[model samples]
Target: MLKMTKPREDETRTSAKKAGVITLTGQLAKALVQLAGLIAFSHLLTPRDVGLIGMVAVFLLLGELIRDFGLSQAAIQTAELSHGQASNLFWTNALVGLVMSASLFVAAPAVADLYNEPALSSIAPWIAVTFTINALQMQFQVRLARDFRFLTLTLTDVFSQLAGLVLGLIAALLGAAYWALVVQLLVASATLLVLRAGTARWVPGAPRREAGMSALYMFGLHSGLAQLVQYVASNADSFTIGIRWGAAPLGIYNRAFQIFSAPANQLLAPLTNVALPILSRQRHEGRDFYPLLLKAQIAISAALTFVFAVVGSLSEPLVRLALGSAWRESAPLLSILSIGGAAQALSFMAYWAFLASGNARQLFLHSLVTKPILAVAIVLGSVWGLTGVAWGFSLGLVVSWFISLGWLAKCDGMPARVFLSAGLYVLQSGLVTGAVLWLLNSKFGDHAPSVVILSIGFLAGGAIYATLLCLRKSNRTVFRSVLSPVAARVKPLLQRN
Candidate 1:
């Protein structure tokens, strides 16, 4: 038994590293694909088309969240999961997904009526089918996640997105109107089918309803609820804008928000993917996780803040060049919202802490508190129109960031001072970024050679922020701890500072 376990332990270590690398690589690839796809699709489709899909996406997101109900997360986090547990969860997910999809299909007209968009009456149901298609692969996908076989996982996302991009473009070329949305959904479904077959090792079986699984279920349920609240809060602005300002203004807001959120979302996604399983294992072993968690938070938070500050300041020029003048309304919204974007990225570490510690109940409570605050902000801001809504939405997130910091300390045992130290680095970075942008804006003018100014400001801000971080004893120590694995590669860069 000891001899057998030795090799197994070695294999686990090797697999963990591979999964980490795969997670990062996959994020980079997917971001590139998504960026390219967005650019191409934007040229082909109007903002109305994007807004129509965005409206439908609200239901789709809600359905997907409901279908999940936290089972896959439970499966991945639980160390003692059995084959029977996997099978039971799979069927449960499938049943839930089917029901959700059918309900959405039937309710599409009502949703359209509520949103006051006649076009959405048909478009909504077509998007509903994705739930069923998603159901088909949920179990298999969960199993792949359980072992962190992320190479296969990355391949699946890359190929599936590629398929959707191709299909959507073709439909656009053929002048399929909103039916192009259907083609995108169908292509995505096909990709899921292919991915499910490729990655899943387990097959469906008669589920054995086990007694010990309740703990996992309870944890997952709370996690899911927290996730749901977070989702609704994040998208509240989009919903309000779509309903009140209509598709055109909503389109601008959505596009701007999407672009602003993309970097932080992409950076944290792969880390969170790897963090859950790894941290779950560590928790099970009764090891100290706070130090490791803090290190990751500091590194990610600093980089995200620095990058987003630059992006937010240069958003006008960036939007004009990339998205055309039709999207000029999005510039102010983008800048304000990027503040929230940066904070959201920083606070996300707490989410992982909550999950890792099996404290989703506390997390749910936090979201419960945060969501109402956000809702109020959005409601009040919408009075002034879409930009007002954006301001309110982003403001709420900034407030929530501080609240989350307190909760992270109280619930997850992360030290408060660590965040304080990182917060200083972030502030310095933001200030430097603002100064650089101001200088560039003054020298070159808003539209005159904006891209060049944008590029230089970004580089200068990044360099100064990094230099400040290295010079700071507290921040530097944390940074070194987080980047130690690649210290050799980064050593020259560090020295260059």
Candidate 2:
């Protein structure tokens, strides 16, 4: 284990920021591959085909939540860990994963019956295998992250995703139908497992009593349950929509939701990977970690939220271009879901803040309160149907963010200021960008080429946001700092060229 002192704040900041850049680039590459799959699958497979898989996915997501037992986050948050404890956690994860995979396999029939989709019987078992595949490598990836080996992590992520996409596309083209989706997921997990094993080659010793086993277990339990509830909060809408509306609409909802969430997951989620070990160090060292947290929030909100804003505003054309005209129904859903996605981007920091402090209890309690609020919101909104579900999820996420700030008030520096300094201005910029694109979209989206609509949307939205940033000295300074990583990378490449 490594220790840090207050004097090394700048060094620590530089390392964290560099890791973030590497991780985000990797996420960008993976996101592009996922985008390719989304487009290819939408054309090759029907809404019902993907929808059936979506139903099985709802259950598999839970098994995934169970397998890791939150040990990955626990490892990052802890300052000291012996090889014995690492081996213990690894075996525990392997056991949990094996059991979860078997349980899901055995219960596939019940899941199929519940969804009234017979294909789920076949789909659930293979997907279930992913639990063990992913679990076996959880700590390998954690070791890389703890050591800030982000470049390696990035390579692993991109290569695995690319491999999965190519294999899945072949399966789809060969008439695998929904099984192609299953194969895609399995191959991805397996590829990631192989790569991680190769990269972080640490052999686990037999499980034994460790000095801090009790504390580790207690921490992991709360963290794990908190993760489960967090999954429920995030996926409740998918589960509800699939159960209530059936497969066809659920499939569309799933894709639309993925697009809406792309910014948060692809853009901001990687920050958590970079921030955890660093933030844990800061918390351990009695230093304020809120500045880094806030900087990440602003960078995400300004850039990613703006992208989603344009997507929401010009969704019809984007959908038509990406998923084809048959999937127009997803347009409104993506538009509505963007609101929640933007808020969710900022909420990532607060969630990880609790983890960094090793306060799994606070994290768990916060999830218990806010996640239910989200689930209930989605359930109540589902009463009105698919559009209602979208509204419910979006508004619920916004409400959850506000509550999360309040819940974390006594723990860290002012989180509300993170929102105020970061999100509020971006919110204003998103609204403006949305309005401009909506007008352009309203006039020509139906008759114009989608490529044109998207081209103009990207250009105009980005220009508008950038110009607006330049209007204020304070905002310009903030954005310049937030975007330093991209500048650093691009500047070197341009000079070489």
Best by TM-score: 2
Residue-level lDDT tens digits of model 2 in 168-219: 9999999999989888998999999999889875777899887887888889
For residues 1-497, could you state the per-residue lDDT of candidate 1 as single tens digits?
A: 00101012332233544566566677788788778766666677788888888888888889989888777777777766677777777778888889998999899899989889998888877788888778768778766666565666667877887788788879988998657767877797778777767666667778677765688678779988987997788778888888887887778888888888788767786566577777777788888787777677776788788867887778788777667777777777888888778778777887778888878899899999988898889889999887789889888977887888798788766787777567756766776766677667666755577678777777877787788677778678877655676777679999999
Positional deviation of residue 441's Cα in model 1 after best superposition, in angstroms: 2.6
> What TM-score would each prediction reach against the true structure?
0.91, 0.94
Report, for all candidates in order, the number of backbone clashes.
0, 0
- Clashing pairs in model 1? none
Segments of candidate 2 deviating more than 4 angstroms: 1-14, 413-415, 472-474, 483-497
TM value for model 2: 0.94
After superposition, candidate 1 runs with Cα above 4 Å error: 1-18, 481-497
Top lDDT hit: 2
